[model samples]
Target: MKLLRISDLRAADIEAIWSLVGGGDASLRGTIAWSFEGNGIRTRTTFIQAFRDLGLAFTELPNLLKTDERACDLAGYLDPFYDAYVVREANHARLAEFAAASRRPVVNAMSSQGHPCEVLTDAFYLHTRVAPLERARVCLWGPTTNVLRSWHELAGVLGFPLRHACDRRFHETLDKVTFTEAAILPADVVITDGWPQGADDPRWSLTEEHLARMGSPMLLPTPPFSIGRELAFDPLRYRGFAGYAQKQLLLPVHKAILRHVLSR
Candidate 1:
């Protein structure tokens, strides 16, 4: 069982993952190889704590596994000893190749094309904290990046209303979902990915005013989000800014993911 993308997950798998988070999770314990980058401080810390709590050993691979041949060779070498593999890569195709080559369950920590784990964490948090996901109106304000793609896939699977607000220049890349400019939209949960370089529209920056106009929807910005880029005000002072505590849930969510995959 591998989860390389959000669309790869089924409804049953999604429920099972949530169940694991609720406790009484079985052993997902074993040696796990992590091929991740240096900038993944949040991910690394969460994974380390989750692994320790779940009785799994963590090993960081030195190589990025840039090419298929290298990824294949590494997978084969680790297949005998490792219980699972976690890969964080920018290239989706490369991560696919690696997952294809691995005999053990492979988990996508993240890729440029999608981020299943992070998005799942968000959905779970919303459901547990704000309201049922079905009742919430999600508004994603950013370019067509990994986070957006994952949210799109999950929203499709879950049958929720998701709106993408961005610069009109990038709308052509999106499909099927509701699209809008950087104007105020009726949103229960407002999210943002990274800022596009030189897309210096003040409207694109999610200001306190925008949140106020939207009736004080929760503001959950994706990690690596800059203060001045995607945000116009200090999010901490904002009423709906629950990101700091919300992000901490990544540990349990990821632990649930590991258990769900390995249990299969």
Candidate 2:
């Protein structure tokens, strides 16, 4: 019952999660233990609410688990006291290893490799509000990062058309991501992750003019999105900007995920 990545679940699994969205199974009383080192304000706060909604007791792991050995050992160390582990840390290898060592279920909230929950939430939004994911044309605009990787993994699993609009310098090694900004034109939905740190290129930025060019595709900028960087202008001015509206479903989505994980 470990959710390490998006490919771990399929379309049916997503549907199952959707079916269980609004109402949760509270009979399964499970306590959760969580630790965070990644930069995800939206992810952290939303899950805390999810914990409370499910009536699940949760505790924050202290910052003492620094070393890889101690971090992996934490699963067995806290196994008796905690029912489940939620970790949102930076190291992909360490996260995988810690999940391996844990006897209880491990939920990867975010990592250097992917953000499964966020991807799943976004996919759920598309399926429920926009279109079936199999037919949706997706375009992600930004540098290659964890969220993008998760989307890529999801695309491979769901058989959807995913076009990445990024600068050639950023994705020189990535074959699937296109070099030109024209990749956003034919998309049904356009999404974005954070711009590469210390790098600012307006060419890759999303502006009203860009959305207008795309003919008003659903625009979802993954959070911690910058104003002048990933977004060239204020996003609230654009009608297609559905970032906030889309993320509002995170509560139910996270509740479903927690229910599924803890029940198993």
Candidate 3:
């Protein structure tokens, strides 16, 4: 009956989960289905392959663009058949309601409030590549979107130093989180989500100049990045940059979720 939020997990819990993922192949019982509003091609493909590798039946519920009520109804209908429900939607409140009503464990694929799976994968990647979660100086450069919110949640749970550099308009929306307009220097990891629509501010964009100011840090850009907006050049050229597509992270994340579900 536990809601899977990053804030609810302890540092030991995260390490244990990642350890399980690293060990390879966790026990997953019954079927899994993904019901999403957005086109999660990468997510769906990665998860389907993961499930196939694990010998589990996986289904992608045909983009059921339902209203909040209909989505909850669908969740109720699928509760008996599926062991786990992975949902991505714009409505965070409705998703919470659906999770509460579901008999199975609910995974927040993505929501307006947070993107826990992405953050979890990012954390694991950082722990392995950059530094331990406790020691890593993380800097998030973008609006106070769901991705940033999840990072904030992770920072709260793991007690990591997470700095933010965004416009003042978006800064006020972040609760109890302080950010600066000045450049984010001396960072161990520099991450960014997509640029806000209609903002059109070059300062907010993660260009070559900003990357230079950040020194030699692990550059991790969230997927679906634009050339002119998110980055000035192709990230693939940079040795430190994690690739544009994060489909590979999905396997570890799914394994971690399965481990958590089995443990419960």
Candidate 4:
């Protein structure tokens, strides 16, 4: 999982992503994934340089969820995109085709269905630092992307109950998943992140009031927003705090999770 193009991230955020990758295993030392804009030679050249330096595969994909066919077509190029691709908010049929077509594994990437890797890591992190996954009440606040998909996947796999709070527009109908518009409620695990959008301004945050509403001990992967201040310091408020499963470093996390699942 070298590269991704979720609208939730920006070019500047690439540094933090690099940090995670750089600190990962030597097997992934050179793997790279990045967002692309097909402007002209300069943009392509820059992207090439970045990949060359990082020793990663390259790809260009539309960041928005507009047409299914276009998304499928774009995802079909996973070989050129990345050694392992993560197609966020894409169609599962397209993902299946990409996986079938590519000799290399194209992870569920991401769709409305589930983000297996994200959930795996989130559950692993929670299990490691806080408590058993099955013994927790996880609360998710945000839209239906890899995050919510992850929650559903984690809950199903670990036999945990998950409650979701998202704006109506981003909410989807699912049998196992329950949705609500009210503010986030506390649970054993509380994960909150933003909707993928054009602008990634740090000011868009879940307020202190929102945080106060949670009833139980918690885990926050990344906070609800990307403010300049570090969210890790607020440990006093929440019993056990963890950064949101860093999706930026999805490659290593994805690979680890894939190995875990496929190995089984």
Candidate 5:
């Protein structure tokens, strides 16, 4: 059996996975569930819908803070029942440790280090809504947080042009990557996850003035966006904005990946 981490998947494999999911082959079914300990309505809703659509059994473990020993024990317990595990937690190190201990394939929902699944959905959105990914200019605004880290990882694999307009403090020390102040104006897609939890940085906010300058580019703010913090106006008013539809794109790819893992 092989571990199916997004970092290990090739570009072709990603395309194939999405294609498999979009085809909606009802024959594919399995026991899929998530073990998370935070508020992730969008991710949770999307996974449940994906599992239901694919005719797979879905369950969510109770939100419990497990000790390392208990976490490992639970993984062994779930090994006999589940085909895949989606984990969302604040600690990346612990999540990585859990994935290593788990017998089944582990899908990272989100962690302190990265959010691969969300980035995968972003890729799918660009593939369908915007230009070809190889030629697309993606501008990431805000901190070098988990989402940006995942994008950085993805850029290495996919060879896409990813530029960032971030605070000097949040800038990543990646080689050959461009960090620009003018990225918002020329970007094909402008993405932001907003500021860190309690920090208020007005300069990073996606104000109406900034949007006006972003000529016809797609706007994707990672879900549960704060109106005043991330965007000045309601994103629902923008023609290029992606809300639930962006989330919907994740379903097929997620289902496809799970199905592929099960077959292997």
Candidate 6:
């Protein structure tokens, strides 16, 4: 199966997957052609037979419906476009429509709306670490930009309750969900992710003080800074586990979704 990921992944990062596949089944192509005023196309490599990026070379579509149909046709005509069309964290409504129209499995790798697949990874990882979803109380503290989609998807799929805490800027976005900044954290689980580059606030970070109150077996998407294996006795903190692992592990699931969409 072929894969198209526009999430700025480096060629070397997927080396392990390439090695196992006996090498050179995939190729990488970069492009910003879908969006105007975007960066130009770049090149990379992968395990697939080939990969290509259109870059910001054209803007012929004036209507979303028409653009989507064109994209769908492109996928249909292109030999490597069938397996998956991963719209990586894009906010393009037309692209989503095109993906749906292309009859290709669409992967919501990351989106301004939601990160459902990441939520799947989190659920699987938590289930493997903990006993049950009900047994865990997750505290999600960060900007809604990244977690918004994932949160909803997680709740829908696992029924696991999540308590949210966001800054004043995003309070309106949290209107649908019950939340409080003063809510006691370090519950069964705590997540502090998706930092804004220029933002000054750091209230959402999992500080050392926060770790003190954490229960046994903490899970942090990013690891803490420590020189050596001092083994800080702050429960079994699952650190350094990135969201990309989910993308790799869930390839089969994505493939099925792609096949079903394309079969139409």
Cα TM-score per model: 0.92, 0.89, 0.87, 0.52, 0.88, 0.55
- Residue pairs with backbone overlap in model 2: none
**Clashes in model 1: which pairs?**
none
Deviation from native of the Cα of residue 181 in model 2, angstroms: 5.5
lDDT of 2 by residue, 128-202 (tens): 788988777778887778898898878777666677877776564433334454554667888888865666777
Per-residue lDDT of 1-264 in model 4, one digit per residue for the tens? 322222222323322332343343323232333332223232234334434444454454565334454544655554463554434444555555544555443444445455444454455556655776656666776655555666665455344567886666656665446788865556776676545654233333444545566654564744244433223235445545553334333444444433322222
Output the number of the TM-score-best candidate.
1
Off by over 4 Å in 1: 24-27, 172-176, 196-200
lDDT of 5: 0.73
Structural RMSD, model 6? 10.2
lDDT for model 1 comes to 0.81
Which 10-residue span in candidate 1 carries the lowest summed lDDT?
169-178
lDDT of each: 0.81, 0.79, 0.72, 0.48, 0.73, 0.42
Which candidate number has the best lDDT?
A: 1
The true-versus-predicted C-alpha distance at residue 212 of model 1, in Å, is 1.7
**What is the Cα-based lDDT of residue 20 in candidate 5?**
74
| Per-residue lDDT value at 144 in model 6 | 60
Ranking by lDDT: 1, 2, 5, 3, 4, 6
TM-score of 5: 0.88
Error of 6 at 202 (Å): 2.6
Off by over 4 Å in 5: 1-5, 68-71, 182-185
| Regions of candidate 3 where Cα sits further than 4 Å from its true position | 1-4, 63-75, 172-177, 244-247
Cα lDDT tens digits for candidate 1, 1-264: 989888898877887898778584455558988888557888878877888888888888855576446777977877998898888887888888878988999888888788899999989998878888878888888677788889888877777767888878767544437778756777888898776556666667788878888889988888777888788877878877875777888999999998888878
Ten residues in sequence with the least summed lDDT for candidate 4: 2-11
